[model samples]
Target: MELSDIRKEIDTIDEQLLPLFMKRMDCAKKVAEVKKRDGTPVFNPVREQEILDRISAKAGEYGGAARIVYNTIMSESRALQHSLLGAGKDLRQRISAAPKAPRRTTNVACLGGAGSYSHDVLQALYPQAEPSFFSRFSDIFRCVEQRQADLAVIPVENSSAGSVSEVYGLLMQYCFSIIAAKTLGVHHCLASRTGRIADIRCVRSKDIALMQCSQRLATLQLPLSEISSTSAAAELAEKDVGIAAVCSESAAQQHGLKILEPDIQNADNNATRFVVISKEMCIPDDAQKISLCFNVAHTTGSLNSVLSRFAAAGMNLTKIESRPIEGKDFEYDFYLDFTGNVHDPKVLELLCSLEDELPRFHFLGNYCEMK
Candidate 1:
């Protein structure tokens, strides 16, 4: 066919498709009416699979594409049915009962002391809040859980170091909600008791700090050791002339260590994202970021189906991290963050649908993330 003729044929087929899609939805409404009367469930996996099988058999070369299209049509049909039946009542109720704004108070807890990155974030976001520093991540979580603090500001990820797995684990264990988040620019320095870079024989810092400056450390050819925090490593370096620490300039200053190298991280854009978590759930009106944790259904294509729904809703998913579920040999739980407003009907419906469908899921929180 000529190019113009092919374009004309495509337009004609699209014109024919509109009415067929509308009629199909009208039929779906009637089907919903019958199901409501019979007290039948909305989703019917067996019937959907049978229809898919039948359609694929005759589709020939277009078999895979045909299945995808039909699958979407059926998904939309089930969604309509769910709406007609007023599904997701529990989650809706929870949202209605939750506070729209987080409580502003002075009891804020975070990991590390005066010059730690977490401390920096706490100062930025909750300057007026009283700070309680802990040596361990769990200790901070415990403080919040026991109501010793109103909130916790902690680093969840670093741009150069990747996700902080220990923090993720503690977030799940504590079951706290992230009411707000902050991302801060980071610049690392190599500090030691002596201000000479040539005197450094070994380095010590947090694992994340080590990784962030891995490239610079590789050239030094020094043995490395892991400390609990960058600030703590600086403290140790202040006491030993041979050992070095990769930490913030402020940390080295506070610990009385001399800076041997400044800005040692691999990337200039190195930054850390911190979350202000609370025991209470809050959905602020300005919430543009939503965090969710979920375990996918075990059936084949289940994860694809979940992600497809997000794509269909036009949601911009920004982050996804999978962690092994404890006590389960190979099962994983996924932590996802996406830009969305729960007040939007489509967004709310997507969350509700997933809550009802996923094997395990938690709406961690919805809040405005600040830079």
Candidate 2:
């Protein structure tokens, strides 16, 4: 057959597909009505799998593509069902009713003392708030958990060294709401009282900090110890001439140590992203970022289905990371950061769908992010 004839036939098939698609969608709405009347959930994984299985068996060589098409169509069917039944209405109301954050919070917890990078974040956002510095990341979480502080400002990721895994673990453990985030430039320096690289025998800093400066630390041939924070390392380095701390220049100055070597981190543009966590959810009018953690079904295409919802909504996913679910052996929980204000109708609907359908779904927070 000629190419033009094939195109004409394809056009004819496309014309036929539209009416069939409409009929299927109409039937899907009727199913929703039945489900609503029966008080049944919108998502029926078993039924969906059965349909996929039967279709795949008949489609032969195009099974995978056929499965994808049905997945999308069925996903849209579920979406319509969810809408008709007003799924996530309660969640939407609660999110909409969240109180706006105060103009100034009174108490704040951070992971370092004096001149650490976390302190810089604190100074930028909550300088007026009473600052309680903790030695460990867990301590910061505990401080908030115990209501000793109103909020905890802690590092979540570094530009070069990657995520602060311990902090993420703590976040999962505590399940606090992230209210805001900030990113600050990092400039790691080898600081010591001796002010001499030759005199350095040991190096100490936060694990993330040491990792950021691993290349520089290798050339010095010094033993490294993981300390609570970069500032604490500087404090330790100040009292011992043989120890050097990989910390910010400001931290060294605060602890009466001199900067022996400056800008030692691997990346010139190294930065750390910090999150301000609170016990309550607060969505400001101008909020533009959302953070959530949850697990999808341990089945094929489950994660893809969840991601597809976001894509269909025209939402942008900025970051995603997985950590082992504490007791679930090899299974994991995913942490996702996406760009959307809860006030947007489509965004709210998508979030509600996720809250309703996903397992262990936690709407961490919808908040404004700062650079």
Candidate 3:
């Protein structure tokens, strides 16, 4: 057959395929109704696996390609069933019903002391709020969980050193909701009471800060001490003439230490992203970003299948990271951030589908992004 004739036949096949696809989806809707009535879950992994195996066996030499096609079809069918059954609707409703604006007066929790980056970002994001400082990140979460603070500001990731994994683990442990997020540029400064670099014999700061300024610290040949935070290190430097702190300029100023060198970090464009977590969930009117985490089956292409859902819905994913599941040797939990508001029907449908189809899933938050 001529190439043009073959193309015409392919087009005809697609036209026939569309109606069959619709009919299959209609049957899926009926299956959803029966499952809803029987209080059955939307996803049946064992049955899905059986169907795929049967189809692939019948497909002969094209088994692999056939499995891929059937997987897409089944995934769509599952998503449709989830939406029809109103899966995840309650959480979506709660998110949509949350307060549109944060309270004018709020108590906030932050890691480190008065002049750390978390403190600066918290002040910038919530200028009027009262700030309670903590030495450990866990304490920040605890403060919000116990209602001692209305919200907790914690660093989620750093542009220079990648994610703060401890915070991610704490997030899984805590029950608080992330209500807001902001990114702040970081500029490390070397501060001392003597106001002279020559007087410094040792440097102190948070371990991450020390690492961030390793190139400069190596040149100084100073012994590094790991303190709880940059602000704490600055406070230490204020009491000792020979001790210098690797911290923010604001911290040195707050602690009455003179900055001998500024912007000493290895990278000139270093920044840290912070998330504001509260006991209650809230989705503001201007919210345009969402964060979620989920686990897929250990089978091949499981993760890609989940990601394809977002792509098919025209959602733009901003970030994706995988962390190993605590007890499982090779299994991982994927954390994802994508552009879409909870009010968008496509976004809601995707979330509902994932919640129903995935073995483990969590809707971390929907919030506005600030740079």
Candidate 4:
């Protein structure tokens, strides 16, 4: 067949695909309604695993690239589900379920601009919160410490990368509690003013941003410069010539930059988890978890002893982190998150026991269900 004939056939196929895509989205929306009614989580890891396996099994039938189709479809499915359950639900709801009057205005401080990932997570988690943006994580924490900001959002860990040690160290010094938690998928790209792939000179990004895109960047022989953050890199590109930034799409739009390329991270499954911190304790409705930090006595089975406390109380522990106490060479403080609100009888009993046994202790916060 002639090339024009082939193009016409492809166009016809595209016309058919659009309707099917809309049908799929409609079905996805129904799924969201079911989940909300049943109080079931929107994300199903087991179902996702099954889909991956089924796709891999059919690799031989799709012209030797079965894995590609599986991945693309899985990604689309996840994105669709996320949208249906997240902002879409809010839009669909008839009432303006805007947040209740802040028990007190939570002046939250976070790294970067209005549309940065941290900011996005904050807005989702606390729609009524009054957010204040800071250029650095240290600055964010300081705002909370000085009462300039009532709370601060800090990235603690990533699924692809490991724990953020700097934040861990800061946690030890600050008198703040891990009041809440949020996990966000990190989708990055190489954004610039030009669409051409070859007209790039230097790629500017933060250290973490570069590390996330290391494998992809290695494929292209270009100069790499480290900046303060992904947003800063993007801002720099707006003022400089022949420069691009490895930043999020939200950041690109906020900085008035265009996406020359998208999804340039080394791994498609990149995600970051952040913790909300505040100087004062927060008690919210639907509270399920209580966080505490303390130092164990110098003795063997000390860590085990702490774990036994939860077991004794019939409580489940969610997180445990140890950090070195400043000015003390060997001493360490352990942070713990366990099931049960502070108001629970068993939880109160556990706290009383820990106070009698442990040397130092601080209660972070009892977080309510954000969903």
Per-prediction count of colliding residue pairs? Answer: 0, 0, 0, 0
Order the candidates by TM-score, highest first: 2, 1, 3, 4
lDDT by residue (167-240, candidate 4, tens digit) is: 87677677576667778889998887664557689999878878889888888789899986788888887776
What pairs collide in candidate 4?
A: none
Question: What stretches of model 1 exceed 4 Å from their correct place?
Answer: 327-330
Question: RMSD in angstroms, candidate 4?
Answer: 19.9
Candidate number with greatest lDDT: 2
Candidate 1, 261-318: lDDT as tens digits: 8999999999999998899988889899999889985654567677778888999999
Give TM-scores for every candidate, taking all chains together and pairing residue i with residue i: 0.92, 0.95, 0.91, 0.67
Models, CA RMSD each: 2.1, 1.7, 2.3, 19.9
Provide the lDDT at 291 for model 4. 70
Candidate 4 lDDT for residue 244? 90
Report the C-alpha displacement of residue 236, candidate 2, in angstroms: 0.4
The TM-score between candidate 2 and the true structure equals 0.95
Candidate 3 residue 201 Cα shift, in angstroms, is 2.1
- TM-score top scorer: 2
lDDT of 2 by residue, 1-371 (tens): 99999999999999999999899999999999998789888899999999999998899999988988888888877877777777787788878778889434798989879998888898899888888988888788888888899898999998898898898888877888899999999999999997988888899999999999999889888799999899999989989999999999889999999888899999899999999999877888899999988898888888888888888889999999999987787788999999999888888778787788888787889888899
Query: Model 1: clashing residue pairs?
Result: none
- Please give, for residues 121-212, the per-residue lDDT of candidate 3 as tens digits: 99998898989999999888877778888888999898888888888877766646778899999999999998998898899999888888
